[model samples]
Structures are given as structure tokens and as C-alpha cells.
Target: MDTASTNHSPHLHVLHDVLTAATYEASSAMSVWTGGKISLTLDCVREVPLESISEEFDLGMEPLTMVVLTIDGDAGGTMILTFDEENGRGLAASLFKQEVSTDPEWTETEKSALMETGNILGCAYFNAIARLVQAEFVPSPPAFLQDYGPCVLEQALMLQAQCSYDVLICQTTFLKGEEKLNWHILFIPNPKIGDALQSAQ
Candidate 1:
């Protein structure tokens, strides 16, 4: 195992520039989806212990709307997109072009909207990475859930636990026109990707 690849900080240091470069592609991807201009930027990224995942988002015990995507390939892992109630509803409403339901339960339309958003975001990153690593990266259909933030992260982390003690996490901010979407994507890459990334360099 490469210590540099599994370290708690620099594990993603190599990715900062790569992700920054991919920002344009990600933004373009979203813009096409929304049928208008959209900007997506990588806010921050780092490697952290399995248990410390929730700390990155300053999440408490609050339940959150989550969309989980499993990236399957030679090197694969999970990507989790999460938002609190206010932001989640706001996003759903934006896509619906109308007010969404106020009930705690998410309607089928709401679930589909969220999943499609997650899929778009996940594929943008995966597509960029695949080009760099020269490997096909496919994401499963996003799984929608409403649960405690930590609980959602736990399920995502479980997928990568066998790959490494420290997981690489990235935070992305997306905006549609002047509206800054308060949504986030937490990426946990499989350790096997270290080879692909390193070889690319």
C-alpha cells in the first residue's frame, strides 16, 4: 500500500488541481441539464477517517435528504449527495418549477428529480475521472433516502471500508444563475484508483 495514497490529508492533494481543471466540465454538464447556465465548483477535498465523515459537513443528528450513487468500475466507490430539508425542498422546487409537497414523505416526482440531479453530478465527475484514468466508471442509479446525516454517510462509507482506512472526500458547490444551490457531494474513492491516477501523471 502506498502511504502517500492513504494518508489523511495529501491523499487528495494530487486531486486538487485535477478537480479544479475538471470544474469547467462539471459546470458545463450541469448547465446542459438545467437548460441554462450553471456553475459547479469544487469547494474543498481531503482524506479523513471513516468515523469523522459527518464532521466535514458540520452535520448533527438532523435527518437529511440523501442520494447515494455507487460508482462501479475497475476502481469504484460511493458518492453521496445530501441536503437539509430547506435546501432539499428548494432544489426540488427549482426543478419542478412549482412548489413541492410539504409533507415529510417525498413524492415519486420529488425522488426522481433528486436522483436525476445526483446522477448528473456524479456522472460529470466520473466522466472527467474516466478520461484522466482511462478506465470506464459507471454510476448506479441514485438511491434516495431521508435519514440522519451521519447514518447516510455510514452507509456510503461501508462501501469503501474494505479499500482503505482513510477515504477521500470532496465538497462541491453548485449554482444556477444567481441562486447558489446549497447541495453537496461527498466522494469516497476506492484505493484502486490510486494506481490509475498515479499512472496518469
Candidate 2:
């Protein structure tokens, strides 16, 4: 988490800026929601190799709770937000002003809370990208998954193969005060959106 990385591909410079701005917006929205200043740590925004994603994220076979949002229109691809159970329950508890649930099964309210959080964060992220690329980007409702991190990520990568190999890695860890939370966001933009970003740059 301390190491910072960047891709020097001139083709990716504009894209990095777009994703960075999106993270900033997401941080602001989170701060407003919590009534306390919160920020997302952007260690690097780069084009990550598909094959290296598992190693890069240290995903291994660990089960993680994640949200996936598919995007369509002028831009395309999917966005994934991942966090462990502790972080997920803690976040929901904060928003709902209730104790974190100890149950293994997610209740209807818990699912709704987490998905809504994903919607807020995804909207903030896509809004920035749309502004930079000057294109329409529509995000579908979030789908929650509890499975091996690498498995979910692999499915996402397979979907990306249909469009382009340009997978953008925007590594962020949510921060409340000085404490780092186990939240991360990963997204891949299809060629259509990639082209728009390059042209805009």
C-alpha cells in the first residue's frame, strides 16, 4: 500500500487524470455521508496487466465482499469495489447508526445499504470520467458478491477481453481520520471509452 506506481504510456495519461478525479469526488461524497472528512488513498492509477491483477492485488483465494457495476453507452466496462466482511459491516453500521451485524448472512437491509453505497461511489466515479471524456456513461445497479477475490476479478477480466486490453487500475484505500480501511476500487474501461479519453487528451 505504500508503494506508488504509474504507467508512462502517453495513451494513458488522460485516463489516469480522469480516474484520479473520480476518486477525489468519491472521497468527497463519502465525507459528506459520514459527517466526517474521509478520503480515498490513490497510490497509483495505471493500466494494469490482466495477468498480473491477482498478484498485484494479493487477491489469492481469500473470500471478499464486493460490488460490481456494469457500465454502458458512450463509454463502457465495469467497476468493482471490494472490501472484507469487517469493513463492509462496519461501513453499514456507521451509515445506519446501528451495531455491526455478526450474522453470516446479509439481511435485506444490509444488502440495500451496501448497494446504495456502491451506487453513490460509482456515480461519483463515472461522473468525473464522463466529464473528461465528454461521453455518456451509464452504470447499472450494483451486484453484490461474496466469493474468492480472484474469481470475481477473473470474471471481470474475461468481460474486458471482449472490448480491449486496456484495464485501468485505480488503487485506493478508504481513510477515516488516519485509519486505513480495507476498501478498494478497480475498474476497466472498454475501447470506446478509452478512445474518447485519448481524443479528449
CA lDDT, every model vs. true structure = 0.72, 0.76
What tens digits encode model 1's per-residue C-alpha lDDT throughout 107-156?
Answer: 88888988898888778777777787777876798899888878777766
The predictions' CA RMSDs to the true structure, in order, are 4.7, 2.4
TM-score of 2: 0.89
Clashing pairs in 2: none
Worst window of 10 by summed lDDT in candidate 2: 1-10
| Maximum-TM-score candidate | 2
Task: Give residue 69's error in model 2 in angstroms.
Answer: 0.8
lDDT of 2 at 17: 68
Name the runs in model 2 displaced over 4 angstroms: 1-4, 162-166
